[model samples]
Target: MTGGTGLFISFEGIDGSGKSTQARLLAEHLRSTGREVVLTREPGGSPGAEEIRALVLQGDPERWSAETELLLFTAARRDHLERTIRPALARGATVICDRFADSTRMYQGLSRGDLRGAVDTLHALMIGVEPDLTLLIDMDPEAALARAKARATAEERFEDFGLPLQQKMRAGFLALAAEFSGRFRIVDGNRAPEAVAQDVRAALQAQA
Candidate 1:
């Protein structure tokens, strides 16, 4: 639970599954209801972590080995927890994170290599926290990859890994949702944005 009065929420899905858009929409919805919402994203929430984001997100996909990427992501996550997430939670604000440790669990742990054990170990040793609710925006991997590639952003390292990786990630995320079913909610992302947002709200209400 965050060990705080505030609620912590995270969005997870394959690349371009609209999880980021849903995260923003949820934050806005919460703020409209006059709740204190701290909208944030992992790997770059705090200043120090933003620097790490640039290093790990850009460049070639093979720039760093899975082990190295895991270390870098863990460092950024620790900084983010200390500087951003914990403080926001302490102040009793709803924290809507675009992604969290689960992303690392998929990208570095399962997709890149069999490092799920190492990822969990580092998570326990350093950033010992998880969201109160995780909304997985489930969708078709080919469509998601197409949407991700359409962005043409510099942070396309993972997108560069292509559709097969996206398919693998989609399956991995669904498995993760099942593994953490107590706190995970699967939301279909193939509908219109407003419709998807409605489902997102429904999920949160269900959690509440």
Candidate 2:
């Protein structure tokens, strides 16, 4: 429904919710079924976007204000859509993105301030697209934060925001799922990866 005949699936949640792993698993499963699958992540999908990703993801939490971060993320998403997502979907390939605009809605829109209106306006003007299905991996903030910190990656800027931010984000994502219940599927992420994956596949099938 998003692009031609292809399916656009996005994985979203708080930091260390295991959505990325689930995204990869879903891509592999689709590919095994002989469907063309493009497994990608936001903030750094295309070359241009990848450059912006480094700028936004690898610094102190206060390095960029919420407004500036919103702009940077929107720019990255635009480039990603042009160079990666749209093309893949137009070609009838399934696109499994690690995160999408829902993230912006929470991180920039609500986390820093009440900028949901601005985020929505820019999204409509620039992106104008949403995933056909969004898989929300719901998890406890404390556990999720632990997992995120365990990664210790350079792109841990969001993770470095600590537990309170994670709690806020988890609540925001749940609210978002309700806001877009038509296309959003909530998956319990506290279980093992394989079990969670089974639920994810079930959600996709139900969508079909």
Model number with the top lDDT: 1
Clash count, one per candidate: 0, 0
Tell me the deviation in Å of residue 104 in model 1: 0.7
Off by more than 4 A, model 1: none
Candidate no. 1 TM-score: 0.99
TM-score of each: 0.99, 0.99
> What lDDT tens digits, residue by residue, belong to model 2 across residues 31-134?
99999999999878999999999999998989999999999999999999999999998899999999999999999999987999999999999999999999
Which sections of candidate 2 miss by over 4 Å? none
* Top-TM-score structure, candidate number: 1
Question: What local distance difference test score does each model get?
Answer: 0.96, 0.95
Model 1 lDDT tens row, 31-100: 9999999999988899999999999999998999999999999999999999999999999999999999
Cα error of candidate 2 at position 146, Å: 0.4
